[model samples]
Target chain A: MTSPAITVDRLTKRFGAVTAVDDLSFTVAPGRVTGFLGPNGSGKTTTLRMLLGLMQPTSGQAIVGERAYRDIRRPAQLVGAALEASSFHPGRTGLGHLRTLAPQVGVKDARCHEVLELVGLSGAKKRRVGGYSMGMRQRLGLATALLGDPSIIILDEPANGLDPQGIAWLRGLLRALAADGRTVLVSSHVLAEVQQSVDDVVVIGGGRLIHASTLLEFEELASRDVVVRTTDYQAVETLVRERGWSFDAQLDHHVVHDVAAAEIGAALFAAGLEVHQLADHGADLEAVFLRLTESSDAPTTQFTGSASAAPAAPPAPAAPPVDGTVAPPPPPAPPTTGGVA
Target chain B: MIAALVAEYRKFFSTRLWWILAIVMVAYLAFIAGVFGFSLTVDTGADAQASNFLSPKEIAQSIYALTSPIGYVFPLIIGSLAVTSEFRHKTVTGSLLVEPRRSMLVVAKLVSSIPMGLAYGVLATVTVVAAGAPVLELVGDGAFLGDGDVIETLVLSVVVMALWTMMGVAFGTVLTNQVAAIVVVLAFTQLIEPIARVALGAFDATSEVSKYLPGAAADALLGSSFFSSFGGEGGGTDLLPQWGGAIVMVTYILVLAVVGRLTTFRRDIG
Candidate 1:
């Protein structure tokens, strides 16, 4: 495989007694969007800051290209970053801010205009950044990051404060950037957003990496709990009770245990039961995320986009099961670091 | 270095603060020169005003001399503003991230300050010259300062302003808050240095130490002729001799700038 565009090696950072990033390690390759997923204050920001060399890592190192970020002779052209949308001189126009950063990255001034247009900020380029709404600021921030045509882009919650259209625009932009063979590492708590945009996932909790893999792989690993919903809910639930199957109840529907769809279909036919739905329900990123990060006292989860990387546990065992039914044992998947997969 | 320098200049000029501050400096200089011009003209009268035989340089010098006291403040603002503004806006993080080799940026900031400081000095110098023209014409060419003196003064003014700008940079690095930097710079200029110098002067044993004080050093660089009366032995009042002041000031700037840049590398920007 080609060298990862970004490689963070056992990085650690501390602010006084609080350890922000603890021995975190990951690699983001080119041609893909790697979702750096974590909850708030979970060391995601600190790790990103260290990756860009905005903050000194207490130990370890972050490499962009072949060198550490601090050692890169022309960093802007190598790795473009947008950490905070509000980090700008309020009195300066958006165009002015871009112009200043463009030359530093060795890009032509025209690139600024091009990027402004790319991020849909062309019409507002002349406006002072202070006057911009958060959504507009985020777009402008993205434009700045793209100005240099960097080989790698690192954005911390770049989609924050964006409307649906803005988020969609950002998702498409990231995809296009990755298509051009650039590495895009975006950190956010929104799994759904990452679900829609990212190609790979790097999941972390409590300042530790949980797992890293392709998007589909992370989904399978993180959401192993099979959800089954049927209109003949009472009959199915009663059947589950008779068999001592444990499951969560739903409004207007019944969610049974990990019973395989094929087995359920045959049993329902044999019992002369008609069902509206018997499809196997896969876990959404939200459920997997909450399940993976549920230590009660765990740091507040900031959902940039919903994407998970660890295999989830089955529902509680106390509920009754239905006749001729057994939850399919987890999906046949690769070994997970922290969960049974 | 060129890329970083260009970036520094771009960031410096793109902000509204620089323009507004420039306007304020121009207005203040014009007002001061106007007052000096009128005074010199009224003293010399209309006959001298018509002959226009006066030396333009001396009139320019005296007008500039009166105006020079105010000159330091603006360049100080420029220096502090250049560095402190980045902290104020939190763009320092973005700037450093783009070029993590921060020492080069500090150097670029110092290099860029020269041209900017020169520009402000030229504006103030030209305003004094332009305003002093009528006064020179009125005072007779004899009262007009020679070109040698004018050139020397202008060059000295530029260098002095540049040094102060660098000093302000050091100050800004030492104190990231713009208001606090301004306050400390102002306090040093108005109170701290003066008090320190005065207190130091009272004791003959430590009087020599006062010459190296920041205020005295800056005063020497401006080629102020009045330093001898400030208690130092005639030649000692100047922290450095004619050309030595620039070298000394540059050294101070280099040392402080390096310290500032090193400090920045170790900072964990939030």
Candidate 2:
């Protein structure tokens, strides 16, 4: 019943003849982190800009906390953002920049150092921003975004250049922010990072919304196939075909299509084929992404995690297990699983 | 709006480029005074009786005139930097995100430039005037505070220069490129305006039209002193009356400012 933290309704933007964002509509709720995922040149940043009132939409409205960004009387105290974390004066020290922005945002002077410490940049607070590394700049940016103590935080590519430690730190920070019942909208091209950090996901491609769903629903809808591996793989394929079940043939396994793993196992056992390994491909979001983005010219055959469209790298090995502790099995199948043939 | 103005002020002062420009203006003033001091020493032979050559009021007026061209550069640079830094740093996205009413932001910037411009204008004038005091003492002529007109002229000149600086901000916003804006202003102020003004004097209609030029408004600040040496109503009439110059300057500022605001408010920050 509560109003969404961010509402973008029927938003559109045109640059000359090209429509960058076309009738895009979505809402991000409070108390959760929403990931805004899209490919490059897909108008994600443009949409964010419109939402923040940095650029007026051609037609439609964007509201943050029930009011337009322009109408927010004390904006910084209501919504904090880091659009470009590095857009700071090179000569100004990190703390000095915060101090300079403090009076304008109407926050207490002490919050400057408070946010600095919160972002783990307290050590580099006195250093000029020019000398800080990219990771340090990202932390400083997070500090600025948190300085106002606002209920809403928006960041674009917040993890673009972070090291693994920085990324882990950022993941924890976002989790903590959402835990405090605040709204967080983060945009990134990396689906894996978003999968790890956000509760909800809104996928956009070519400036249009592809899907908006909870992470569980997205994974359920996207993870569609099960791979069955057995020493009698040939017999299993024959049984699947004889039963009119369609599946992809692989080196040592069969990716049974449409039918469930239990159904496949029942059919295989009925055919007198002993199954050694049987499991669904463990939560590969890329398959769903490929199906969603699939078209005649679109490259869907190379679907894999992180390196989907990388031409020279071959296919991505596979998605890591969802628990984050285990790596996905190696490629060229071990003659017991159903995947590559 | 006030918050934005304050923020713009902070952005302006926080730059090392601004500090460097300030030093340049102050140093230029002192350097000119030093050169003038050298000239007086050579011309007056250091005798107390011939000290009239170093009259402080005359020297003050002369320094005010001689360095007038150089004094205008700071405000121009300040105005350009105020807008261009946003583009150069890509902070326009962050700033516009905070203050969505971008026209108000442009207005804030225009308002903010006034103080810094005033500081430069006042300081530049004061430095030249104050430094002239001792040099004039070396000449036999006594120092004259003169009437309130001197103070008024100095104050008005500073105010006019501040407006000039805001005009530069509008220029920066329209161009959105720091270097291009600065170059255009410098070229027009230093070279083109002077040439155009002289060429206009050859014909009465063009001469009258030239009064509306930005340079004409700048020259108007000095009042009758610009025509002091000539006879018959100082031998030259203003292109426009003094008030007309103010009107012309304000008009230039408003047109460019409105265009600048509209452009900035509508354009995508990225």
Candidate 3:
């Protein structure tokens, strides 16, 4: 099978008044594993569905190998996808399920056993899917996706029901698929779930593109912030604003970005303020993801400018943390993402 | 196209539903045929009405044709399930992934349901003959299996079964919800249509229209029915000729299949 790049060119899907996918654009190049990351209800599945031609885009297009999915001569052989693990007839055995698909995929019955073995489901090939555990069903779903040995593999939340070992196995398998020059797009709400497998990340929130870049570039957006709590809140807030450090002032504490915990502690000590707590709250990928998606509207331009310059961009002071520790200001500019075409 | 057809057949045989429904259909047809054969042939001293209205041969032919009138529901259900089960289970995603052409998938489903319908037809016919012939031979005239009209009705019964199954597939394609499709099939075939046909046939004006109903068309296609043998021309409506019945059933299948293809079949699988 030929490896094909998937391109979503301003694809938009509006369900009545609500837009599920709002002019989202991203190109998934071949020979790399790309993570389609977003929180739940962020239109990740809608984008994938449009890409697979399982859904209609309101406007624009999703092109696979330069053609719409419906126009592909043999789509399964070109793009193997498993959108849901539960998309199986419970009465059918794993092998039976594969056999039903094998003929349409233009593969021999022997290929069914081969995929079952590939997904580590050979032993339970004869057992009905109704009796299979969620993890086993996930394996079967992976097996189904691998049936045609397609070069472009799209799996939506494949690791949702897997155990640690299964997740490890999936990571290895995804890496191996990309190593063979396939374009693998695996989507998940949690960035860490696919952190080890994906080479690039395309993040979306509220049906709009928030960030798209290499994983290394995305990780570089994780800034080191210092959370400082003190009795002299007025003085600390004045110092933070005076130093031009981006910060979010909570009711009892302040999260100061682009500054070390030691620096904040020294500043507090010099002011003779009673420092109750000072800790380095190193912003990890999860935190960066939350920051970007939580204030998705504000960061749309901030992150999309360039990953390297993302840190230097002014942080939205009003963009509150998602932990619900503070009442966030009302978000502004709902549909002003730069990717709108 | 051939690959899609093979895939559809593989889908059908992979489930236990076909055989389970087959068993239910066999028992139903056999019990109904046996009971009817016994009651119609038995010498009730009240009146010689059974013998005077129709010959033992005509009665025997009617019993053989019972395969279509009473047993068509099984093939109908099988056809409906063939389409509805895929949607119910969301396997249409996998199906479209392989074929990608929605129209081709619908065509494959329509074509594949034919052999399934034929298989059900043969099974239902065999059950009727196996259970009904013995009762007919013992108390009434000899089992007229070789008679031309009986043989014709049996063959037509098989064709009728195949048509009914195709109709089921078409109907299921239009009404994709599994519960709704099955309920509609059972209620229309078992309750609504029968009652409607009788109610309509009770009048001279509507009796002609009642013969055009699906069940009546199927019975008309088979060229005989025990219900018609007793009530012919007096209380019951006259069925269309065999060719006319075939045309009517084929029209139902074609119309339903077309509507389903243009509407639900073309809609996004999600």
| Highest-DockQ candidate | 3
TM-score for each predicted model, relative to the true structure:
0.83, 0.80, 0.87
> What class would a CAPRI assessor give candidate 2's docking?
acceptable
lDDT of 2 by residue, B218-268 (tens): 666555323221112312245566787778888888898888777755677
List lDDT for all candidates, in order: 0.71, 0.71, 0.84
Best by lDDT: 3
The A-chain TM-scores of all the candidates are 0.81, 0.77, 0.76
Scanning candidate 2 chain B in windows of ten residues, the lowest lDDT window is B227-236
Give the alpha carbon lDDT tens digit for every residue of B19-85 in model 1. Answer: 7877887887778777656654554655344124333454456565543455567777789888888
Ranking by lDDT: 3, 1, 2
Q: Residues B1-270, candidate 3, lDDT per residue (tens digit)?
A: 999999999999999998899889999999999988887798787654666677889878877888887887788889999899999999999998888888898889999988888889999999999999999999888789998888888888898899999999999889999999999999998888878777888888998988889888887788775457755444355789888989999999999999999999888778
Model 1 Cα interface RMS deviation (Å): 1.0
Using Cα atoms, each model's DockQ against the true complex is: 0.67, 0.46, 0.78
Residue-wise lDDT of candidate 1 within A1-341, one digit each (tens)? 23257888888887888867767777887778999887777788889888877788889898888888888777787788899988999989999998888777888888999988988888999999999999999988888888777788999999899999988888998888888888899989878877788998887766666557788877664333344556577787777677676667778666555566677677767767777776676546676565555421132322222233222322213322212323223223422122211
Per-prediction backbone clash count: 34, 6, 0
> Cα miss at A212, model 3 (Å)?
0.8
Q: DockQ for candidate 3, please give it.
A: 0.78
